[model samples]
Target: MSANRYPLEVDVAIVGSGPTSAAYARILSELAPEARIAMFEVGPSISNPPGAHVKNIGDPAARAAAQRASEGPGAGAATVNSPGEVKAGTRQARPGTFLLTEGYAADGEDGLPVAAMSSNVGGMGAHWTGACPRPGGAERIGFLDDLDALLAEAERLLGVTTQAFEQAPLPQKVRELLAAQVDQDRVAEYRVQPMPLAVHRRPEGQLVWSGADVVMGEATRNNENFTLFDNSLVRRVLTDGAAASGVELSDQLTGQQYQVAARCVVVGADALRTPQLLWASGIRPEALGRYLNDQAQVVFASRLRGVEASQGAGAPGAGLSEQSGVSWVPYTDEEPFHGQIMQLDASPVPLADDDPVVPGSIVGLGLFCAKDLSAQDRVEFDDQVPDFYGMPSMRIHYRLSEADHQVIERAKQQIVRLGHAVGDPLDERPFVMPPGSSLHYQGTTRMGTADDGTSVCSPDSEVWQVPGLFVAGNGVIPTATACNPTLTSVALAVRGARRIAEKLNNSLLMSKSDNRMSE
Candidate 1:
């Protein structure tokens, strides 16, 4: 649709076209096919043919060029270079190409920076590694009811499977060798299995998953009522008294401001921006941006000594191949950290016959420990210094607690032990990734059983102060889960969408009844 054809109002207006909003839009559209839905995205709509810039994931130069070409002229550069700017760095993945245009703030105390939230249409889902593990009982939020059903539905929607590379020889042998070193009690407790991934095998047996775009792209494309406004940055939720009336949006290309009147609004703008929008609109609950939490990750890389060069052949870039699989060590009561072991196909070493060991066969182990939700670790909006979108830039204040530090220490010891058991350890010690580098930020707009000032939203993900406003994303997850929070967050969004659908349906019925009475 052309920019002139964009609707002035919608029954449902969703901010942020990430996984959470995509899931909500999918479910709600199915429930009410006749309803008008508008999804606003701050980044370019590059997923479509004209702007398909994500062609090469392995080639950094190609990816960067593609991203730059997609942005066109006048788009600002990415504010963050790497997670290291905020003291957070990732060993497995490099800085994203599309994230170059996004903005983030640095902390004054430790100088650790928060992960740059993607302003693109797909949000962070486009750049994620596709690891989708369900949170265990210990990791689930205590107040979230119907957890089992929600997870099941979420799994179905994500097409999660645990057999992506189950038949791989190297990963199997590594797991077996590692299990032999640990006692049966500990082995059973940890329960290492094939990592659950949101991917599917093609007819030629290649694994692929195109994030939320694949999940709901067809639905949005087919449904004319569902409209997408890309390169539209949402400034704030326009509220009338205690109720949300619409949203103020800015065209990133033209720098034109517009209002999108909505009967109901859902904000899935990630952890930082979600609260920033709320705070910008003067909806400052005490816990609006407090209780921020992200998994504390520790990463270690090792080379598999004595492995034949031929055996490590065909490993795809960014690690997993037909011959190698990824393993997950779920969080247990005894060990409160989630662990993963995967082959790094993007290792810097070259594969050659002369070398004693196979090059590019570096296996990486990652430990993600759940951090306690604390008010002290939060995001502050600096309205004085506006970003390119003319909104307040964020300043993150995050510090690892004593418990988090202890978990990292324990995880380091375990990584060393496993390294010796699997292969020759390369680095002197494992590197502790900076906080927020995990890209699993949660608990900012947490849902609670009550509307107390401590919680930003109710159990149904409805804002306590706003009747027709809702929130969906990782920020709504109240628990500090060690596992990847994407699936859990999507599950919560599904639940919220159902509630919103029911409310909208009931309102429609009431309007008809009132019209009949007036006649």
Candidate 2:
């Protein structure tokens, strides 16, 4: 859509422009074409095609700059200080990947110190590793009646495919060796396949990575009802008698604030910040930022014995060497951890020595175990303090339970066994990373079926008691997942989109009814 005037009312106002926000906006535009929608992104649009994946940029310098841009404003500063006070160095999966933690994280509480976010037009969608595995067995949300349908839609929008490296030799070898390591007793639900990735392979032998742009479709272009406002920071969700009425936003570049009315508000501003926004909006609940979960991640690298690296084979210029193999160990009752193995000819997983690329004869291995969810693990805000963005300050308090430690131990054993099957494990490589290192923080605004104190939002992603206010993104994931949460989070947003469409459809019906009554 051509840009619309400011301060105008919109049917729906979406915060954050990652996969979750994109999913909400896209589905709403499709299901309710007449509903006027506006998406507000806090950071500047970094890409020329705005929201295109950094991997899509061929030049090394351009890609690196875009990645850093996604890292948020503090990353460009001479002295970085997003966490309010800095003690430990800011950590991230890669450059242009993570926004520094704003306010305070329980640096002593293990995982909270490293929990981070990304701020850009596309958010984390522009800089993800593209691992899009589906939940299995217990990892699937049992309450979702339309689980399969939602997942299918999310996968379609992400362009997820198992055949991304169907022709790569290294992946086939890794799958074979990894399969041999899995206990024969649990083979039924624990077999392997090529990694599911949100990527498209063109006939020209180039691969285009999925980002918020891919998910947004033409909503930002041809849809007259949809408008994306970049460099606008939403500070609060305006409410009127238990219902969302609008949002208060400020221009990030100019510091000019605007009061834009919205019939409904949906916040998907990553996990940590989503809850922060809710707190800033004075919608705090007992469960608003409780039950914080970051899956215990164990990373290691191993030398490949028989497999040869196809340097330019599957992923082209992208870091993915051979498509990941058996992207899951399958979260089952007996083995609750998930395993991801990648042949890193030019690897992206950071190892102690490898940095970016593992030797051609090496493969990177990772195991993620679901954390035991507890009320004690949480991220709270101090109304008195202000964050880097001048909002309510955040303080995360998290720790691993005894059961969590047991899970981590078992994950270590599992990865070591699988490592032996592939090659020799590198010294100091096969070890558990600090908490939050995985960057898969979840469950802050977790959903439940009711307005229970244990959940901040309803099962459909609407905040409890706030009828028109909703929350999405990883924060709303109620589960302690073993796989990457992007696909599942996007799927959950699909569910929310359907609910929002119904509300919009009813509003239109009521207008017609009122007109007839007046006549």
Candidate 3:
């Protein structure tokens, strides 16, 4: 069958094939196996047969090249075509197989090195480092009810666990050494502990990172009622009064437009695009694209002087072993910074015949400071200038606050002290990465207890004024949390999917009752 000939109607339509959307699909498939569902993705599907990228994980350069090839010329530049095509020779690929479009940010914001995101089928989850940590009680947003239960379910769905390091003792050693040197009260407040990762460790001691595709691949393949359309960019949600009826989609490659009707619609197109799509569709709530937040990070790297590096560094097995050594200093109610320390493998060196290989190891630390969600930090759309998908061009607005700078200073001091304690002082002071570099953008479509002008979604993740419309992803998180938001976002998506499933089941039951009464 032609790709264009897909079913024009489905029980539910989801936009963006990211982790949040995949999680929603997984849950809905289990809860309502017969529910007809369709997922729309702006980027092309993974290369046929999958696993090509997984195989290249050990070769950073090759992986980067593949990502650049996939991203095309538009990977880092702005485009006005229907589907942004990658330009030739634009190959500063990051450490993944997916490439992100450049120049989406407005003029002033263009200088900021925002964390590049994947536009492919799996979204950022495809390129993520799999760091999964639960937000502390202080980081939880008050507006979201039953946060504990939601998190518990999310952890289960994502396979969040600390088992990966059960055999790796490096983290424990580092934690103990740090604890001994630091004040007991300060150590308790910092809550230093082993970092929890969203990965499954096999019986053979191999780790299987949980990507969106890994999470939903089997379910999508097994469920005949489910369909996925890639390279299909959704331009807008079609609304009937306050309720959504479907969406208008454009094929990124062919520039063809079509409409699909649905009983419910969900938008999980990341933080930036979710609001952009809503605004383009004229469903602009007062706070539709406001209160954007991202974790501002201070990165520090140090080489272990007087130590020899392992011979087989940069290999996949070594990388996994290094990952097992990862540890974290979580933020507390008293302190607003969360820290992580990990061992870095050796870089690829050009070896000479006579040169002896004195391999050395490096340790890197990242101090992430929480930024308060602010209305001024937002995403705006320019309707006059259409992008590759014929949607409004986006502009990102963000600025660091004075308080944020203070936290950075504190983080730097902490890193310096820790470095000295370990006798691996950093070559230089901590470097503060540009805003948005963390890839933790959130709060553009925040959820709140009430549908006030400040929030976009209700507690159930439904659009406040738009019935039958729901949103899932990091953008729905109402708070500025220092920890990675993937697990939390997936959890919220599960919660939202539950609500939508209930609504659809109820509608189906009522329709049957009405039919019987009429007969």
Top-scoring candidate (lDDT): 2
Local accuracy of candidate 2 as per-residue lDDT tens digits, 1-519:
134346479899999999899999889988888999999998878885667777777778877777677767457644332211221344533566554455335556564555667778988888776778888877788898888889999998787888866765567777777888884767565676666888765466665677888788875456798888888889999999889999999888778778888999999998888999999999998998998899888877787675444443344555344444334456666788887776653334443344343344567788889888898888888889887788887787888988999999888888888888877777543577667767788999998887769999887999988989999999898887888889999999999999999999999999999999999
lDDT of 3 at 67: 50
lDDT values of the candidates? 0.71, 0.78, 0.70
For each of the candidates, the C-alpha root-mean-square deviation to the true structure, in angstroms, is: 4.3, 3.9, 5.5
Total backbone collisions, model 3: 10
Better-scoring candidate (lDDT), 1 or 3: 1
Ranking under TM-score, best-scoring first? 2, 1, 3
TM-score of each: 0.87, 0.91, 0.86
lDDT of 1 by residue, 1-519 (tens): 255435788889999888888888888878877778999888876555211215324566755544453432223445344323323333222333222132333435432343545556677666566677878857887776698788888887777888766666677777776676554666453566777877665565556554677546466568888888888888889888889888988887787778888988999988878998998888888888888888877777677766776776664443235665667778875777887776664222221122343433567778898886688777778778875567787677777778878887988888778777777776657777755567788888998888777789988898998988999899998887889898898899988889988988888899999999999
Runs in model 2 deviating more than 4 A are 1-5, 77-93, 98-108, 187-189, 308-326, 345-347, 351-360, 516-519
* Model 3: worst 10 consecutive residues (lDDT sum): 346-355
Q: How should the candidates be ordered by lDDT, best one leading?
A: 2, 1, 3
Candidate 3 Cα RMSD after full superposition onto the native fold (Å): 5.5
Model 1, backbone clash pairs (residues 3+ apart or across chains), number? 5
